[model samples]
Each structure stands twice: as C-alpha cells, then as structure tokens.
Target: MLTFTNMRRVARRAVLFCLGGMILTACSGKHEGAARYRTNCGICHHGGEGMKGEIPPLIGRIDLIAATAEGRHYLADVLLNGLNGPLDIRGVHYNFSMPSFRNRLSDHEIASILTYLAARGDSARPPVFTAEEIAALRAHPLPPSAVADERRRLDGIHRLP
Candidate 1:
C-alpha cells in the first residue's frame, strides 16, 4: 500500500528522467551535421579555430567565399578536383595541396558537406548547396591545377578583403 504523495513523487521523477533523456537526444541530434562535416573535411579544417587560420578554416569563411557565383563554382571545383599548389586563403598562404575527393565522395555527399560547411561558417545567412548544382559541376570535371587557376580567377573577382 503506497501513499498518494509517494506515487506523485515517483511520477515526477519519471517525468524528469524522461525530460533529461529527451534533452540529451536533442543535443546529440544538433551535432549530426557537425559529425558528417567532421568525417569529410574536418581533418583539414580541424573542426576548431586552433589552426589559427593556417589551414584555411572553413567554419567562418565559406559564406564569404560562396557569396558570388564564381565563388560557389570555385568551391565546388575545389572539392571535385582537389586544389594543388600554393594559395592564399583569408590572407594566409597555405602550400599544402588538397587531394581530389571526386572519386572518394559522391555529388550528393559533396553538396551535404558544402551545406554543412556553409552553415558552420560565420554568416548568419548561409547558402545551401544542392545535389543538382554539384552534379552540374561534376559533369565538367577539371584537373586540380585547373581548379587552382579557377580559384585564382575567382579570388580576383570576389575579393573578400
């Protein structure tokens, strides 16, 4: 035989436990995109600001780079065909080359990664990359060197600073 007050307390505890579990799930859910991004590009981007702008961190720069049409294309091309040689990103020069991920990742995966990168950037209004757009770029695949050339042209056209 249980008292009414004890039953109420037990019920309250159960509700509280359920709420806590829900909150944890929601928090983990929010990081799903971050996880996907980490799997694809985090190795280079480092998933944090520790690199101090050395490896061309994408968290806060993707929005600015993708603001223009050419910028968008350059970004996609970079992913599709890698970027070779030295290039300046956010005024910092990084010589290490990025290998082509065209074969490693699908176009849809590319779009998802880009969208994740853009959303993680410093822009409040991040641009979304669609699978169709990535497919279009993939149709005309370019070499890494050509991608670098395109980046140079686009950089001149869309100067961030």
Candidate 2:
C-alpha cells in the first residue's frame, strides 16, 4: 500500500495545493494595502504601534481621527503634505517631521495606505479613503507646518488621543 509511486503522487498533490493557495492569495489583492504599508510606512510606524516616545501610533487612533469630515480631510492632507513641528499626542509631546509622499505615491496607493490604517482601528465603521478623495486633497496642497496647525485645531475640538 505504501508504494513509491503513491508517495510521489501525494507529495506532488501537496506541492500543487500549496502553490495554488499562494497564487490565489496573490491575485486576491486583499493584501495590496498591507504590502504597500509594510514597504512605505512600517519603518516609522513599526506595525502601526509607532515608536514609544518618538512616533505617534496609528492603530488605536486613526479611526478616531477619520471619524469626522474635517478629520478625514486632515488625514488626506497629512499624507499629501506631511506634518512638521511639535505634537501633543495623548499629552506626550512629539517633535518629528513626517515626510510627504505627494510625489512618491499615487493617489490610489495613498488611499490604500490610509484605508489600511483606518481599518486597523477598533471603530465600528472605519473610513475608506478613495483615490478621488486623495486627488481632491492633492489639488489643494498645504505646507507641512499648516498640516500641523490643522492637527492642533483638530485636537482642540476633538481631544485627540
């Protein structure tokens, strides 16, 4: 019953099955945002947790940020224009300049990244960024300092965490 041909057949089937699964996942495009996030944002964000003292976390906070219309616009603006100067996140001061991806990433890619971050939060309804929304933000560019100012304004109204 345990013949060499039978063993070979089983091994081949296993290999084919593994390959099929990999191919299906690749084609699904479900991980497109994840792949982009890993390559672009993971360095600073570090699994969306951010650095303890340096960078601000995105996981538990982004959804809250994207909840409002102004907040959604702010998120898009941040991606397009970046943010510079001091920030008081959850009462901790962080002074770091986030580089703009305006020239580097496409609108779709930026939307994917934002959508990915928004979805990672525990919000009942996470905001989904679209290429059109990103394009709208792209049309009217703001300075990094201005984006920081917007963040401050938003913090005043929302009590950002």
Candidate 3:
C-alpha cells in the first residue's frame, strides 16, 4: 500500500508530465504556424525588388509600426482585411492594394503571420497583434469608399506595373 506522501509525489509527477506535454504541443503549433507564414505571405511580403514600388518590404517595417499606436492599429487592420490604395513606408509608396485573407486563414494563423513579421521585419520595435484584435478588424471591415480613395491617391503617385 502507498503512503499519503508517496501518493502526493506521484500526483505531482503526473501534473508535471501533463504540463510538459502541453508546453510541447504549444511549441509544435507555433512551429507549424511559422512554416505556414513562410509558405504563404513570404511569397510577396518577404524580400525582392517588391514589384518595383508596389509591395512593401516586410522586414524592418515591424519596428517602424510599433513606434506609434496608430501605426500598430493600421498594421493589424491591414493584415486582417488587406490594405487598399497607397501606402507610404520608409518614404517609398506602394500603390497597389493587398488582398484580404480572411476567408483563407484562421485567427491563429493570422496572429502567427503578424508575429513573424513583427519579429523579422524592419521595425525599431516589434509589435504583436492579438487574435482578438484581428477578429475585431474583420468585424468592422474597411469601407469600399475608403479603399477607392486610397487607390486613386496611390495612382496619382505611382503606376503599378
């Protein structure tokens, strides 16, 4: 027969084992999400000549966006609903709008993409956009009129090739 002390020890070990398993599962999920971001968003957002003034560079911009609350909000909204019109980042203007991925990606996937971008991009401070924030952006939606206005504004600055 086991003593009370031994029973407590066994229970403690079981708890620890369960916690370890949970941690490993969470880590695996993150790894998979990172891979998905590379396969999807990395195609256009990662690196390259960037369509010659169309798509913005993802790297290094993360810090820039984190510097201001409005910038952070805009970044989250753009990722959730896609951006339309002219976007001026680091002095260069991207005249084309990005398509929304709401139908294709889950909230967690979107959060992972944002997390990757925030970590790897060119911002001075990386900003993480929460899944809740993304869901909220999706709920509100960007107005078509606003998108059209941005498109026209961008057209005035540069022609998309």
Candidate 4:
C-alpha cells in the first residue's frame, strides 16, 4: 500500500539513476576511443611534439583545413591515399609523407578516428565521416597519376627560409 507521493519519489529516483548511467557510459566510450588513438595514431602524430618540422599538427589546424569544401575533400583524399612532400600550414612547412591506413585499419576504425578528430580536435567544422564513407573511399582509390607532382607543388607553397 504505497502512497502516490512515495511512487513519485521512486520514479524520480529511477529517472535520475538512468540518466547518470547513460552519461557515464558515454564518457567511458569516449575515453576508450581516445585511448585507441593514443595507441595507434599517436606513433606518427605524436601530439605535434617532436614533429614540428615533420608531421602536421592535428590539434589547432583543424579549423584551417576543415573549414572549406576543398580542405575537407583534400583531407578525405589524404586519409584514403596518403599525401607526400611538404604541407604548408599557416606559413609553417611540414615535410613528411602521410601513409595511407587503408590496408592497415578497418573502415570502422577509420570512422572512429575521424569522428574523434572532428569532435575533440581542432576543426573549423566538425566532420562526420562514416564507415560507409570509408568504404566508398576504398572502392574508388585516388589515382596515383600525379602524386609526385602534387607533392612538389605543395613544396612550392612552403616559404623558403
């Protein structure tokens, strides 16, 4: 014989508990994904430390590169096919070849990395690259027609000191 007041209290408590559980679950998932990035991608990325003149920083340059359509397309292509030579970011030159993860990583893994980068890293606009998108990129690989020339062209853009 529970009163209406007690029922309301129980229901409220149940709702609160459910909400807290959901929040904790979401946080844990994010943490796990970030840890994966550190284990896998961190080898080359290195959080932009000790990579100043080699690899491009993934943190603050997201806004500069992800803001426009061309930049986004370039990023997508790079992820799929990998880019070689020098990349100029905000007047700084990064000379390194970004290797493709197509064969090494699964589509889901790539999607998760992109999602994490877009959500947590610095990007002008958040990206939503799905597993399906990765599949499509794989299906139609970027042509290797002028990769060398493109690299040279990018090098030209770098300010010579």
Q: Which candidate's TM-score is highest?
A: 2
What are the TM-scores, per candidate, against the unseen true structure? Answer: 0.74, 0.81, 0.64, 0.68
Query: What lDDT score belongs to each candidate, Candidate 1 first?
Result: 0.77, 0.87, 0.65, 0.63
**Backbone collision tally, model 2:** 0
Off by over 4 Å in 1: 1-33, 48-54
What is the number of residue pairs that collide in model 4? 1
Selected candidate, larger lDDT, 2 vs 3: 2
RMSD of each: 6.4, 7.1, 6.0, 4.8
Q: Where is the poorest 10-residue window by lDDT in model 3?
A: 152-161
Pairs in clash, predicted candidate 2: none
Q: Give the best candidate by lDDT.
A: 2
Q: What is candidate 1's CA lDDT for residue 146?
A: 94
Worst 10-residue lDDT window, candidate 2: 25-34
lDDT of 4 at 70: 46
- Expressed as tens digits, the lDDT of each residue in 9-46 for candidate 4 is 99999999999999997676566546656776788887
- Cα lDDT over the full model 3: 0.65
What TM-score would you give candidate 4 relative to the actual structure? 0.68
Ranking by TM-score: 2, 1, 4, 3
